[model samples]
Target: MIGARLDAVSEIAESMQTHRTSHASVLEMEGADVTSSQTEIHHIIVSVLSTIGRSPDIQRGLTRIFHRKATAAEFIAVIQAILIAAKQLQQLCIIEDKSTNQQRETLHSVLLRKLISIASSSTVINGAAKLLSALNKEAADRQDLHNLFIISDGKFPEVAEGTRRVELANEKLDSLIVVHRKQLRIHKLEYTSVAGITHLIELPLNTKVPPDWVKVNSTKKAIRYHSPEVLVALDELALANEQLTVVCQATWNSFLTGFGGYFAEFQAVVQALASLDCLNSLAILSRNKNYVRPLFVEDDEAVQIHICSGRHPVLEAVLQDNFVPNDTDLHAEREYCQIVTGPNMGGKSCYIRQVALIALMAQVGSFVPAISAKLHVLDGIYTRMGASDSIQQGRSTFLEELSEASDILKKCSANSLVILDELGRGTSTHDGVAIAYATLQYLLEHKKCMVLFVSHYPEIVSIKNKFPGSVGPYHVSYLTSQRDVNGDFKSNEKMDHISSEDITYLYKLAPGVSGRSFGFKVAQLAQLPVACIQRAIEIAAKLEAAVCNYTEQQIRRSCSLSHRQDGCKNEPTEDVLESDSLSSGRVEGLDDISELYRELFLNLNFGFLEEHGDDRRLQFLMQARNLAAQLIKLWSSGKSTTRDLWVGHTSWFEL
Candidate 1:
């Protein structure tokens, strides 16, 4: 129902005359015309059509009327609401023509005709006429009539009799008061009313009163009494007032009951107004943001999403001009899956989210934040992003991740738009890679949906090789400086060695895989301790070297076994021969080099190195170079594994 309403509204917005009017100009005109009543009326029409689209009274009244429990005031409110909408529609037709161009006059005429048709709806007209006829003209003219109940009583004789009785009782009470005053012979003697007491006679303390008069109260200067006749008249007055209230309520209920037959018609008017409100809101959004209407292809067409220079709708508003736009192109017949890779905070998630949001906005019949967008309507949009776990549900983060992935695999179809960000990140590296790889393979080969897959694992990009043109590898582009702000040269030995200080995020997408996520740079940006960051970098480098060494050792062991199995008749492969020579040249003393290095530097005071004078730093560096020279010389001459040589040379250096 909402989608259908939005579709109708979007169609109206696309064909509206206000599309050509600049929102800025409209704002300026609105500001300049603040004092003009006509302009104020125009603003009212716009507000009614846009912001105040829904009428709660009309909806609730319809329900109450259907249940035979509506009140006269509720019926009055619903009728007045519909009548006001018709008034606003007429105002809109006039207001719209003032800004419409000559070339669009015919279109404007057609639009006005439609508005006129709604305003001239027989139900609205007859309902309003009936309401006006039923209400007193003077009461109807008041701005607030919620409490006004001055309806004609000719049809309700009970109310008429109640009113007449109350009037006669009041006259009889007044006549008795006059008679008491004359008999007391004191023109000033009058009723002394107290809380819940009325028509009590007051006289001087020394004066005498009738024996039938009941003494109500006494003060130092006066005595008060209630006359028997006055008490009887008061009872009559209370009864008349109570009876009048009951009959008036019944009369009002009867009045409201007359409008029940037109309940459907009133509801239709309110719905039309609500829809017009939505259409006006969409028109305003499109004009203000300079958003273009998206073109949707037929359902039978090949599934495709091709957006040019699309911006994240919400981020663009917050960032204003600083927001960067990126293009998206996915075709089921070609590359339907994109493997997105980039450093943290490089806009990978933002890019994929933008595409999904644009697709959703387009399908909802709203203009998209893009240069242009054209796509086949998607069946569904499935997203698996962020990390969370439910403790009460007995699910860990990894379990939750896999559960959503499993659901997506089960439910998503070829026409679905799937966005999976950093899938399998909660598990071990090898397991994460395997899971992410298998998931992408399934999505590509089985579902074949349009997928935007984001991951920190570079190995995931290798899936493109298997799928060929079906998979595309892309990354958020960035720039890196060679030196830090302090003129310290950045390390070049590692591809991912760049620090946060040396990196500049372009926030734009580009083709090719990013070898590193540069998470340490993100750590630096987050202001982690310098010592902690340095230690992490060192540990990462060590792990990389250890993995490489392990691979080399495995290859050498396999080659040696193959050679032995073949009886050493055939020459070994080039890689095996190189490994053999390198292994043969390994100095046995180097076996303890790792332990010696750990003892020397594991607890080194990095803070001391940073804060100490250059003289002391240079001396410490010289000792390090001396130790390196001794190790190189020892490695040059093959010696059996021993700790004596390394210990003897490093004995003079303090740990």
Candidate 2:
């Protein structure tokens, strides 16, 4: 129940923030300055409704009504307040009849007028009247319903009779108090009530002398007693009060029961109020932030999104003037997929999010945080971002990431806008790249949606080759110093590694792919141990060199094979001989240990051992022991490097 209420409130808030202000009449307003009228309307809305929006009481009441948890009193109060505001807004919209010229109605005025009409409708008026008539006039006036039912014989005879009896009982109690005061000869003596026991008289301990009086309690200074007449009155009062409570409860239940007929009407009023609230909110946001209205393409047009100088609405608010704005352009007939690559913390995610947010704000009819925007209305916005594992569901982080990606693939269409950030980063690099690649291919070739993809994997950028003109590569531009002339680290060292001090984030999107993610800089910024960083750099460099060597070898071998196929029967070239010599040297270096392992495994006849029993098995075991001893001895002497020994070999036990 609480979740449902919260969801309703959230929906209301979102609607208010993004409610579009466009109307045909406003769009077609002639001889009137539309922008100025809009500004004036925003000012009026802010002035009229800002206080109500900030009132927690009003907001809570509205939320209750929205969720149908409100009592008649609560519903009446909230509707009364909204109606009062609507009237005030209506008066503001009214132009004097004395004016010679008529004023053209603006969009804001039209919306305000619509709100007033809804508030003043017969349904709302009759419902309010019925509720007020059923409630006590004084309680209704004060907007308090602690005593809900009207104590009138005409409206609720049972409640009225119960009330009369309670009143008469109270009068009888008062009469007894007067009699007791006169008899005690103490005019100031009054009834002392404690813990709901009413009409007990207190007197001096020595002065009490009535046998008919019942002793209630006594202290040193005073003795308390209830006269016989007072006890009878008290009992009548208690019974009358109880009866009144039961009657009042029944009346209140009946009142609510009758209200069910007006539930749909009141619900409509609540919806109108919600719309009014959102309109007012949107006006305020647009006026304060100088947001521009976005122009949406017609349904017949091709899908497109073009934003000029767009800024992230949230980040801009937080960053103020420091937030940098960037442009976005995508079209189904042109570059529909943007592969965004940049260093960590370079604002890649922020840029994509900005684009998505602007699109969403535009579609929802809210002014976007941009200088200008023109886009086809996206049918849906799909995003797969961040990383999380569902432990309770027994799913790993990679599984969750892929699951979201899979859902996106299944659901997204050509008219949708998709944002994927580092789609497959929760697993191995090769697998991550493969999954990310396949996902992008599916989106481009099949879904053909407008995609803003962020990835650290450089290899995924190659998808542009298969989908030419539709895929565009971009990077969040940044500046770096303390690098070689080629804009990289020294050739012998890691090419992408850079100290945090040497890099500066520009936070602007630009063309072309980023060479590296500059993750080491991020690690440095995170304050990882210096020695650990250096060791990582060393390991990274070795891996990079090994990969480069393997690639070069493969290319050369392919080239040689091509040349041989072309009927060249000449001596091997220097490059070929060098490659052969390099390859043969490693093999020759590990030949001794390799031969020992070959003899130890290949010479053992398993079938003969089983038939000959322990005698033949004993000989094979002795040979295996000698081979293991020789292998350990060779390794200890470091006759060959471990890399060379393992380069072309599997396990030593393999025959």
Candidate 3:
């Protein structure tokens, strides 16, 4: 297989050769003629092939042709024929070495490389392409089966000369029969089932028969007979014709097999043609996709990848013009690790995959789908991208994820390209965040390779401050706007309510942290139940409020732990409550109300901030605030004061 892009090989040769070598100089060889025109030489070859009578003739004709000037077309033609034969014989050669079980170079591979090298030369490119086209046309037409060097235009000289003698004898016998016509009667000529046996079916009535005549078949009215001398002549004719036919067949088979001796030449030609074909295919792809030949720096230590306006090759092929292109810059100095956070439908996976593909394509010596690309040589590309479980192997999604990640860390080097998406997503939130952080840290501090880490965990992005320049924080841009909003509503109700078209994904990668993944929006996109979407929206709002309040410390409360007798330790002392109650004239205002119920709040888990009642409830609503506000309203009904409420709730701590 001419697997390497032949254009790259051509370029390499061009760089080394500097000035182009002329076609005449390249075609003119040590043992070949330097004077004859290619057309004349081709005619000479066709003549030699036509005259081939036996294996010896095939050998001599081919040797003579080889001594003549070898044009690129003629050379490629013979090589093409050899390739056709090699395909049948390829099974005879081992594809790989058994001892090492690795790809072992064989004589087959060597000859193939030589052929490709020859075909890629400036002298042969045009001539060989045209020659190959003609040869293929011949194959399609089934007209060019001249590989055996057998001359097919006319009968062989040996067959013709021998058959001529037999025909001449038969003609003389017929003449004798005509001469003897005055004396002998006419007869019907016929043949028997026996080989070369002829007979006279009958003679004319009352005809005079020769004295040496012998009757073979007798009819009722006439006798069938031949002269003894004529029979002898007929026998000789049969022998002569039989010998001639036998010789012709043997010579024909031998002539065709004669080319088998020149397998080496045929193999070289086939290899060259295959390489040229591979180059043509890659050229077409490059042209159609607007691909650019990536630039490579000579410095091996300067490992990096810089792409301008790079598009996903497969996506561009499919979506064409509509696939958005993006830019990437990953270097050894900084931006070594990119933590890409975005909404579900954003192009994070696409972006990372494009970079890796471009790297692979560069290594394969093909142009990449980018306006400009400067890349370092990568040893290999490692990816843990999607959620693929190994059911047959008994590996769950998380287990598969861990296994792939482990292997990447185990084998990847500084020159490798690593793309990881949503690492550790199959575990608990805290554990997943921790594992993701650890994985990124391992790559950054140890591997230091070009990495694209995609994650949804906002807690994971905290590492940006830890690695600063080495780790980048980026997300796909999106828009968040209020739908059908009235400014007159209070802060609480507006904050809790979510409306349609509340989130619009931009799909553009922007620097800094993304606020959220918009899970509810993605759920809606997935066509999840409407009730499910509404519930998710409500929980998300509550969680957001809880997180905001936690960050601002706006609502602090006391806890009345009902689990134990000493649970109310977090509550304010009796003396302090009494002092505040006396300092404030009416009832104590609800400031620092969180401290009043500190024990109860302390028992609440972060998960409780989600959906408080049912259905994996995740809400940002402050339940503690509502309870406090209700309690204050109840007491201010002129029935009880703040101090009296706390005293009365003393029994609530009795677990």
Clashes of each: 0, 1, 31
Per-residue lDDT over 336-426 for candidate 1, one digit per residue giving the tens place of the 0 to 100 score: 9999998889999999999999999888777889999999988899999999999899999899989999999999999999999999899
Per-residue lDDT of candidate 2, residues 489-582 (tens digit): 4332333543422777999999987866777888887999999888887787787676456434433432453334444254333333233323
* Model 1 local distance difference test score: 0.69
- Order the candidates by TM-score, highest first: 1, 2, 3
- Off by more than 4 A, model 1: 1-44, 49-81, 91-122, 125-148, 153-156, 185-192, 206-208, 250-263, 484-501, 547-655
Q: Which candidate number maximizes TM-score?
A: 1
The better candidate by lDDT, 2 or 3, is 2
Name the TM-score of candidate 3. Answer: 0.55
| Consecutive 10-residue window with the lowest summed lDDT within model 3 | 611-620
After TM-score superposition, what is the CA distance of residue 285 in candidate 3 from its true location, in Å?
3.3
Clashing pairs in 2: 16-278
lDDT of 1 at 46: 65
Q: Residue 34, candidate 1: how far off, in angstroms?
A: 24
Each prediction's Cα RMSD? 12.8, 13.5, 15.5
True-vs-predicted CA distance for residue 635, candidate 1, Å: 41
